[model samples]
Target: MKFKVDRAPLLRALSHVNGVAEKRNTIPILANVLLEHDGETLRLTATDMEIAVVEEIPSTATRAGAVTIPAAVLFEIVRKLPDGAEIEFNQESAEEPLHLRAGRYATSLNVLPVDDFPAMVAGDLPHHFTIQAGELRTLIDRTRFAMSNEETRYYLNGIYLHVVLEGKKNYLRAVATDGHRLAKVDTEAPLGVKSMPGIIVPRKTVTEVRKLLDNDGADVEVALSETRIQFRIGSILLTSKLVDGTFPEYSRVIPQNNSRILRVSKQDLAAAVGRVAAISQERSRPIKLTVTKNHLTLSAISPDQGIAQEELDENSVSYDSDDVEIGFQARYLTDITDQIDAEAEFALADSSSPTLIRDTEQPAVLYVLMPIRV
Candidate 1:
């Protein structure tokens, strides 16, 4: 197979697929990328079993053929080539090695038989929908932070995406939690896939799909089946296997009635917690919030280091009953506050309770954090 493609277009497509290709794995074929030229367009594909990314773009095909080359090597060669250099890929047959040529650089890479490259059978996806890339990005950005990394609970390692009803209106909701914190966001669901099957989108797939949505004003076509989901972004397509376990009933963990509400400037609150926690103990990184009528004091103390305290002028900070003392992970508070551009509030019942951090203005997103013992 012989084909010529612009360095920029080829690099962009290869980078996306490179994300799923492993640098080192027990399976030799998993470490390489499959390149196929169908006479007019060249298709590049890479997969790590769980996720696969494919890109098909216009290229000049001299001899129609395919080859498997090291993903990292191809990416690096294209990346280091001179500006505007066109890359030439050639493979005489499956037995011969692939040769790459660009400017003064010429490299030969061993090729693996394309048939050995594991191919994932696309399921019969009955549900097809179109979603604005901008909206999908919001769902990912808001809840991805809460996805668990612990392997014991495999379901928790990915975001739970489903189409459901919020009251009477249909909405697409993304929920993620790591046991200590939870983030949930919802938006109007695209009309066509109202009956779309709910699935656990794996962490790597979530990350890759988010990257594809970065281009402004792009529309992504989504297709879902029982075991996999496909996302078509521009000329690129990604297919990911759905994680197979039931996510915990996270709705039950959210506290509905936390009477004490503490409203504070997002920047001011995040700053106070950040500064104080720098001197707090390492185990807890706990900062105390003392709410009063018109002032909120943030303080943290570490016997080995020192004490840090700061106060924010709260228009009204007193609790429903009296001033309440609550301890929280300073980092968590700062992260939640940073997510909101506007001023926010945290509702709490007492020192030993979950806190609801919410945007003071937006109606769609909610973050919950379980209190940390100091």
Candidate 2:
């Protein structure tokens, strides 16, 4: 196998696949990247059984062949080479180690048989659609923070992607929750996904897919089956196995009628909560919000340290309710508010009930936070 690739462009492609390769693998081939050259373009693939990422880059291939090399080692070598250096890869035979040459730097890496690299097979994926990369990124960014990390409830470990109808108008929705807080964001339904099944996209897949959608005007082609999902972004393709579990009926958990309303500046509320929570205990980090007719008081107390209190005025605050005090974990509030760039509306039924929060500017995204005992 022989090919010549530019250092900078090749490095970027390698970086994308490196994260998919398992760092510690009982199967030796899974830790390496599969490199195949067909005399014009070189294809690089890495996988960890659950998720697979493949990227193709233009290269000058003298001999069309394939080999598997240590992903980390190859990426590191390419990254350290001079900016404009051209990297040459040569593997004379299956038994010989792969040789790499760039400028005055040269080294050989042990190669694994390409046949051992697992091949990702996608059965018939009938549901096909296309979405703007920027729009998809926005939906994922708004909801991923609430995805659960608990392995026992594996269903909650990723974002739930599905299509839904809002007052007879169709929309694509992404919902995620960890039993503490929930985030739900929606976008106008894409062209051909009306019949797409609701799939649990594992946390790792969501993260890797987000990296590919950073380009604003790019269009991402999406294909799905009952058990897998595939995303094609430019010359890169990502395939992930869907989590084989049923997500809870999330709509039941969302409160529909919360009468009390509190509106405040996202920046002001976030800053106040951050300052007061400094003195909160490291474990629970509980903070209290006392709401009156026109004022809101944020306070937190740490048994070992001290208590902190701050009052935010009515400059960007408005409410229509009697006196109500609610306790919440400081971290949850900050996480929810960080995603909003404008004012936030908080609707509550009582101190014990779940509070619904939404962005005043973008109403399609909503959050639900369960109150905690302080």
For each candidate in the order shown, give its overall lDDT on alpha carbons: 0.85, 0.93
lDDT over C-alpha atoms for residue 229 of model 2: 95
**Residue 347's lDDT in candidate 2:** 95
Off by over 4 Å in 1: 280-284, 315-321
lDDT (Cα, tens digit) per residue for candidate 1, span 33-125 = 999898999999999988889999899998998889889888888888888998888877789989889978898999888889999777798
Candidate 2 C-alpha lDDT tens digits along 1-374: 88899998799999999989998989989999999999999999999999899999999998999999999999899888889999899999988999999988999999988889998887789999999999899989999999999999999999999999989889999999999999999999999989999999999999999988879889999999989999999999999999999999998879999998999999999999999999966876999999998789999988889989999878968986878999999999999999988899999888999999999998899999999987
TM value for model 1: 0.95
Model 1, position 151: C-alpha lDDT score: 89
**Model 2 weakest lDDT span, ten residues long:** 313-322
Clashing pairs in 2: none
The per-residue C-alpha lDDT of model 2 at residue 107 equals: 97
Top-lDDT structure, candidate number = 2
